[model samples]
Target: MTDIIEAIERVNGVLVDLSLEAFENDWQRQWLVERGVEIISEASRHLPDDLKARNPEIPWQKVAGIGNVLRHNYENIAAAVLWKLAQADLSTLEKACRSELAAEQSRGRR
Candidate 1:
């Protein structure tokens, strides 16, 4: 929810200016993005199924699995993968989060 949206914004903010070459070389930026993904991954697990159903495009299982990767197999993650995710995949996820939040607010109003 809000956590996921905020984390994505934080990560996207960090990456909005950097290129793949720069992202690969900057360990600090990579760490920040990884941390954000970890937050998104953990928060995603608690999302309601009905909310998830509305955005079937998101790879919800992979979203959860990434936290495990960050925790247990940290060495396996590459900078390129992180760059691609931040640049390409995160917007879709962020959009889903916003959509879910809006839907929840609409339901609350009713």
Candidate 2:
């Protein structure tokens, strides 16, 4: 659980540092967008099903699927889509991860 939270936090931090403008350059797209997706995909793969179940809003399957796409079909991936996902979609997952961490901490203190 802590590992999941930590992973999410790390990805969130990386996403925070990125911007859509970075996708304009081919190198930036490969380094930032592609690598970021790879990191998130690996992190998401390690997340427990029980924890994932708690966050209904997140498309857990799609999250995992993106990783597969990036890994298997790297050439087909769109930088703009990845950029959109990083800027918009990730915040929801990050918020859910933080909420779960807070709930866990509260339970621990009790």
Top candidate by lDDT: 1
Show the lowest summed lDDT stretch of 10 residues, model 2: 1-10
**Residue pairs with clashing backbones, model 1:** none
**Where is model 2 more than 4 Å wrong at Cα?**
1-22
- Root-mean-square deviation per candidate: 0.9, 2.9
Model 1, 16-54: lDDT tens digits are 878999999999999999999999999999999988888
The CA lDDT at 61 in model 1 is 99
Model 2: residue 20 alpha-carbon error in angstroms: 3.7
Instruction: Give the winner by TM-score.
Output: 1
TM-score of 2: 0.76
- Which stretches in model 1 have alpha-carbon errors above 4 Å? none
lDDT of 2 at 38: 69
